[model samples]
Target: MGRGDKKSKKGKITKGSYGNARNRKAIKAKLKRTASKKTAAPADGATKQKRTIKKKAEA
Candidate 1:
């Protein structure tokens, strides 16, 4: 198997495609990051600050 071999990593990269040869770690990591972000809770007082709207005086 050489660079032109489809089953090899180099071949996959040369072909600009992904499969079992490329290992799906990147996909798995992305999924984990998204899941953690969704399940993560903000600490007390760490939540986003509320915005106060100013009322204009009537002329």
Candidate 2:
């Protein structure tokens, strides 16, 4: 149950492998960041307004 145990955090680091103990929060945070980037609103408000205007004109 120490450094050599595969399920423990120390062992995962020693073995250079990712598991629940070693990378859970890091993985979750990374996923959240990417998801937020994908779904985030545009930084420039003008671009969004332009897109809406074009859509309304096309409709």
Candidate 3:
């Protein structure tokens, strides 16, 4: 009946993975946080072009 118990009526039916629902939910939350935290630069390569041009002029 307990979440930590692996024994069942059919003799260790919960031996394989996905035995703990809480752990599975936590794993899903971690994946979602990492995926949504990604940031994208809206300016693309335009902002970096100015820096490279100045360097080329000095050389």
Which candidate tops TM-score? 2
Error of 2 at 56 (Å): 77
Q: What are the models' TM-scores? A: 0.39, 0.40, 0.33
Tell me the deviation in Å of residue 11 in model 3.
19
Better of 2 and 3 by lDDT: 2
Q: Candidate 1, residues 19-56: lDDT per residue as tens digits?
A: 99886788679899999998888877477779999999
List ranges where model 3 is wrong by over 4 Å.
Answer: 1-16, 20-22, 39-59
Q: Which is the winner by lDDT between candidate 1 and candidate 2?
A: 1
Name the lDDT value of residue 48 in candidate 2. 34
Task: Give the clashing pairs for model 1.
Answer: none
Per-residue CA lDDT of candidate 3, range 1-59, in tens?
A: 65346643222335445534436577789989887765544555544444444445665
List of clashing residue pairs for candidate 2 = none
